[model samples]
Target: MRISTFLNVHLVSDSTGETLNAVLRAVAPLFEGVTPLEHSYYLVRSRRQLDRVLAEIESFPGVVLFTIAAHDLRDVLVDHCKRLGIPALPLLDQVLTMWEHHLKMRAGEKTGSKQALDENYFRRIDALNYTMAHDDGQMVHEFNQAEVVLVGVSRTSKTPTSIYLANRGIRTGNFPLVPKAPIPQALLELNKPLVVGLRVSPDRLIAIRRNRLLSLNADATSEYVDEDAVREEITDANRLFERQNWPVIDVTRRSIEETSAAILNLLADRNAK
Candidate 1:
């Protein structure tokens, strides 16, 4: 097997690692192919915690990215990484230096400041709650309350995509289009929700379902992975979407981000009209 190449990055922080995580997510995608295996050491405010984390870094040597506000802890991590022959970066160090030099102001060096308890945070929490509760058409009665509704066949990335949208403060609900099952009645009554459908090719559907079955050690006797059955399901779903006049996204070759972008475009177009 060709093992996937990945970067072993240690994210050290004095508080919650949310800012560091967001930075990594935004920057890592710029580099193609290789993924990051993150080793997060959060709330390391003392030399004692640093001692344990430094030992772990030595055992599994990798580049380290830290958001430590303490000078001694940062120095310890940097010196340890230097001795181990690896790169260590302090995120926002240069920016903080620039502000101190030019603006003549010293930062508070506080942690979790970006995640203040405010209206925006509350909106995200509410969206997350709504998304989780309405997953897989659980709360069908709340269909009219959703900002967006995603309907797709099993394993078509519905749940993950819906959760990602929720993180963006969008109230999303996803429903599965099981073979031979009727569409939900509440779905037809969605007036304000921007309902969208996801479709995939039969071959890809069969491959995904087969791998899913193998992962679960499931019986292959089920029609879930049958190519003909999947094709029929896709056809029926396409027909249903057409009758309902909802936007459709073909996710056979699209990633979750691309699919979400397309949905956003469709929503923007709908709003424009």
Candidate 2:
């Protein structure tokens, strides 16, 4: 007597629920008009840990999608779902099984093998460190060494986009466009790196700066949050972008990925030409 338009899904993972969520993102769009209500359980490695999730699954029985690599724990989850008359699918099992057969080798004896401490992880760490060192134009001497430079006024999504680029192996540096501060000569002198400017709407910048000040428990009555001053700031930044002939991205409504994609496209075009 159970009928539903939406599917209840439990995403269980050993480490962060990133893997299972990513897989679901790829597959869920195929079934149109079907909404998935996801209950994500991360770091579920023990029976006691899974007991709460199992209780929830029994109440609204539906599909269980997981990326659990621990064999015994995986079996326990599958068996419990079976008893509830709920179907279970381990997203990584088929892919890993095929790799095991192809490579003529058994997989490692650990869950979350993809998150192993290795060379690629170290590279990411190094990139993170480099991003931190060069953030907010602190290390101007290293500006020439960057793969990409993000220049923008406050709350233009400069720092987050720079870090995102860094995580993708691009050594990114971001400098804030202060109202009257001098632009870095090193940035203008850089010959090989891509320089991208980020801009946001004055209203959006005002709202963002207001919230930021509130978060810091500081007064929000400064010129930083004034709409007119913010509008002038944006105008000046745009003028700088035009003066330098740097590609500009409007981050008012764009996600970090979208902004970065546009910057990446610019880099590709500049390199190609």
Candidate 3:
């Protein structure tokens, strides 16, 4: 049997703590048999807030990652961690220092710069709104307004992938490809948006559909979860995708992030052409 180890990880930030959480997620999977228990402290700007965070750090006594713009607060946090014999790391200092060196200028001492209410922030919000409005083949007539359109049968992760792309300010819309149903004419006539098809292995699709039915307490013995029927459904979807000449992504072994990245790369390639 494999052994498992649980580690306490403290993330302290003067902002929303998004960066620290992202970094922790990216690095935690690199180690086998180790699971990180996250202790997040956001908006740690004041000394009192730092004191509380430091107290928690002392209590847990684990790895600490911080992204504090103020030098004084950072110094206090680091010094406290040192006293407790805990490893402390500044997540953004190295990148900021490198940029400062390259530009021959000091980095600004501002907290939550990444979460600023800038044009890009508003654009992301707008994209999210658009994505929610156009989800599941809704607003088909406005497909022309989307940057990316995802088409896939049920349980292929079209909605989540569309939302993920929208979070990055790419206006995304997804439509479900129903078996024995005609493809929407609006989807076929789309000229602006880059339409991509998401597909999965027959076995994976069946498993997912089974779980979905179990969750809803619905009948699980229908054609939806039938092995042969699922295979035919996937085959039909693949044929439709091929006939439309749309790019297809096999999502059997791909995460939503990975699928979104592939879609973005496809969009980039299309723009380049």
Residue-level error in angstroms, candidate 1, position 63: 2.8
Q: Which ranking of candidates, highest lDDT first?
A: 3, 1, 2
RMSD of 2: 4.7
Model 3: worst 10 consecutive residues (lDDT sum):
108-117
Q: On residues 1-273, what C-alpha lDDT tens digit does candidate 3 reach at each position?
A: 998998999999999888898899899999999989999999888999999988888888789999998889888888888888999999988999899999999987867855667799899999999999999999989999999999999999988999999999999999998888888788898989999989899988899899999999999999999999889999999998899899999999999999999999999999999
lDDT against the true structure, per candidate, is 0.87, 0.85, 0.91
Q: List the residue pairs that clash in candidate 1.
A: none
RMSD of 1: 4.4
Model 1 misplaced stretches (Cα beyond 4 Å):
1-8, 22-38, 54-62, 70-86, 93-108, 113-116, 216-223, 264-273
User: Of models 2 and 3, which has the larger TM-score?
Assistant: 3
Better of 1 and 2 by lDDT: 1
| lDDT tens per residue, model 1, 1-273 | 656678888999887888789888998888777788889988888899999999989888878888888788888889989999989998888989998999898987665545446688888899999999999979888888888999988999999999888887889999998877877788877899999999888899899989999999999768898777778888998988999998889999999988888887887888899
Query: Which structure among the candidates has the greatest TM-score?
Result: 3
What lDDT does model 3 reach?
0.91
Model 2 agreement with the true structure over 1-273: per-residue lDDT tens digits: 545479888999888887788878878888877788988999888889988889989887889998787788888888998888899998877888999999999977576555756677777777788888999988877877788889999788888998888877778889998888888788777766788889788888898899999999998889899888888998998998998998888999999988988888888887798
| Model 3 misplaced stretches (Cα beyond 4 Å) | none
- In model 2, residue pairs whose N, Cα or C atoms come closer than 3 Å (at least 3 residues apart or on different chains), thus clashing, are none
All-Cα superposition RMSD per candidate: 4.4, 4.7, 1.6
